[model samples]
Target chain A: MARLSPEVTALDTMPNSAATPGPTTLGEPTIDWDLSIRPVRELNQFLHDLAHNARPEMPHVRILHPNGRHNLAVGLQVPANIEILGHAGYFIAGMNQAAHITVDGNVGWSVAENMMSGIVRVKGCASECAGASAHGGLLVIEGDASSRCGISLKGGQIVVGGSVGHLSAFMAQAGTMVVCGDAGAALGDSLYEAVIYVRGSIHSLGADAREEPMQTDDLKTVADLLQRAAISADPQTFRRVASARQLYHWHAEAQY
Target chain B: MCGIVGLLVKKPELRRELGAWVSPMLDCMGSRGPDSAGLAVFAEAPSTDLLRYSLYDILAQDVWPTVLERWNANVDAAATLAAHGQQATLFSTTPSALGKDWLSNYFPHLHCFSVGHVIDLYKDIGHPRELIKKYRFAELAGTHAVGHTRMATESAVSPAHAHPFTSGEDFCLVHNGSLSNPHSIRRKLERRGIRFETDNDTEAACRFLEWRMSEGDSLEAAIHRGFAELDGFYTLLIGTATELVLVRDAFACKPAVAAETDDYVAISSEFQSLAHLPGIQQARVFEPAPEQIYRWHV
Candidate 1:
């Protein structure tokens, strides 16, 4: 409630309360929300209130024509199955607890930022800072992610099917990032315990981050993540990137 | 934050729809920026000896007709003008520099923001929707258009300070990010006798890149040079007589998504603006990469 509402203007976010439940097509409870006329806040508000409702079996929520709007499906605490039909905007599926969200198209900045649990998937590309500072969750981007992706990561797992731009995973504390494509400049700068697995070429590595020989557990991690994301990639081609731990303490006297 | 949008139509039939499509695109981005808005349209150039100048005086109330009458009497008797809101498009056989000097010397309040064979400019301080309505942007016909919705983070909110800053003929640029070293760059350009119209930071970048093109570098080469000279976070969308070019800084934190169909190429800071475009469902949608220049010709 403290952040922007995105509903006050009533410009593109007009309410379409005339949305009706389906005629039982999928065997599970199904509901449709058309974002071309329906407000994004109403969808998020419904998702927020789903935890308090009495129905233990959640309906499948499908969003159509998101139009790159900001703050969609935010702050979900229920275990509902949500699917976005088209491109959504920034901070979509942010702060999730136990829901499974799927985006069939590209997303804007900060997709699934600060998630505590559950899964978030992007079938297309993503903008900057994907899965940033999440306590726990499984996030997937099937295409290239822009710069500063996964910066300051807490304990999230990010799997990218395409390359990541420059300065990805900067100052990451913990978690794992498996990039199926090449990494752009300054990958894993000032890194800590978080590990990175890149299958393609690396532009460069940041301060104190170096490539280590892959262990058996790293292959298992990559394989498990790619399987969960439903992407096909060879685990043997990936290289491990982690912290060198040199900047943990500073030397009092050093040459400039 | 600022919102920048660009559209270039490939098919001749889509030219008339430029204003109608771009107006809603700029209006929807009001969430990111709201203080002011501006638009620069590049129509098919007239095969005449005349040069076109887009002039503005936001403080004046219905002064375009009077300005046109005086220009005909004092500057050029053959000068023809089309007055719209507080803005006007003047067509004359004189050199553009002569037209600019006349505006500066005689009518100091009237600022010529654009001078070209194919470009027409309009900008104001208000909601983007109001600017769109006042200027009758929906009826405009153009080969391409570039627009900006600004929050006035660095300079004053005025018609001059609004975005879509123009430089050498038929060239305009709209920026979505800030520059850390605009003053230093301004000083460097000023040393070369580059006269600036405003102290806004984006003007420095526009003038710098346009200067590079003036020095015989191609647009792509100038942008590569800009990568070395300009220091900041920026996603610049430049429109020329025949092309619309887009580039993001090294980090590319400022977002921009583009959707290209057979009929048109549409770009916005975010995708919401382009959601309603024709055949957008079948368009090849993608995000512009870092430091890469993407150019689509009309």
Candidate 2:
């Protein structure tokens, strides 16, 4: 694999420097890569190398002109902060651990699928399955999230400022999903041990998923998540939803 | 995966560059779809009363002479024909309804990709870039346009199975995902006397919209009804002579992005297609919500 020389000047000598915002002269300048000058494959390869290379401190990486390409910044395992300047395609930051990633534009499907830890934020809407099967971390979307936003989520906190599409949180094993706006049909279908809070109307709920009274603790959790997401919705108006536990254990006698 | 793109020029000054701008957008989506490609462009009609029909896969060396000879014998009207490759466009003063019926009966093998006063369709089985070069898409001028590059998940890779399916007069549709229940949907429409050109799933959706519009439902209403009826993942871009409509399925599994500026409204299956458009950096970009309909006048 080709490695970027350490002696290379950050952004001053980078190709397409005219389009880029220039190097991190004002802040911590660890690394800044522009996708406009290099293809997505090279970027992914560089990220892979960065995760494997041993260093004294985690590197701060900035990606520019993501342009809705798929599988970007996948499988990162470092304690770094990464910022994407434009929209990204499917699985923008999947299988991430100990990295903080932020997207200035929207993201395509499965923004943080199977993420083990860290934070991922989207300034714009996210496509379907925004955080599917993610086990840990905080995933935040300032805009709407499409269907199956947190399908089969094991553990995490997903906060969406806008509406969510159908069948979100379906079969989620353990997680907290907070929606500030309306939810589409069959929300939380066949849900398992996940809590959902919605401030707006739910089109429908899935089998074994029902609304529960929002306790004081639930309100506090929702409030904290909202603050972290930078959204200003009333926590008092939110409703809690969880699995009814009716399908937790199957019965052979019921099959007849 | 399939890629769909639409461009509606809001500024009259940019009208002539519609194809030039859209060609690059379509080319950027080459990786998403490599099986077949199609495009439909809307331009000024020669006459208000004349109806234009664009046909593909005519195959004959002298396509215009062969088609004109047969068509002129069937219909008595002032007509013009233009042919390139295996594709051809016909403009006739004959009533649109009568012309369509007669053409279907006489030219059963030819595919009428579009029928309208302002729309002309070009499509074939090849890569998007190759198709653009063959069709000289970048040089063609239009007011609005829609294009599709198909990956052929649901149908055979053939010229007849290519996208930009014409639904009603002055309207065409391009879809980026598969339908879960197209066979049943086709049966339902067939019972209603809606004819289908191919086994492609998106064609069923096109015909369904046509049937709904024929029953007096507006485009918005028909699309809403589609959300209730169709089962599957899809991001659809429907182009009419006067408007462009975008919609996503309730599941929103397929991806779509829209960018708008003072000059145009552009939609594509991914954002890279819109990144090269003029003033795109300042354009307001957003994902259309699931089951939500977005319409822009041309």
Candidate whose lDDT is highest = 1
Off by over 4 Å in 1: A1-22, A25-28, A252-256
The TM-score of candidate 1 is: 0.94
Q: How far does residue B239 in candidate 1 sit from its true spot (Å)?
A: 1.3
Clashing pairs in 1: none
lDDT by candidate, in order shown = 0.87, 0.85
Per-residue accuracy of model 2 over A124-171 as CA lDDT, tens digit each:
889889999999999999999988899999998899999998899999
In terms of DockQ, the best-performing candidate is 1
Steric clash pairs (candidate 2): none
Clashes per candidate (backbone, < 3 Å): 0, 0
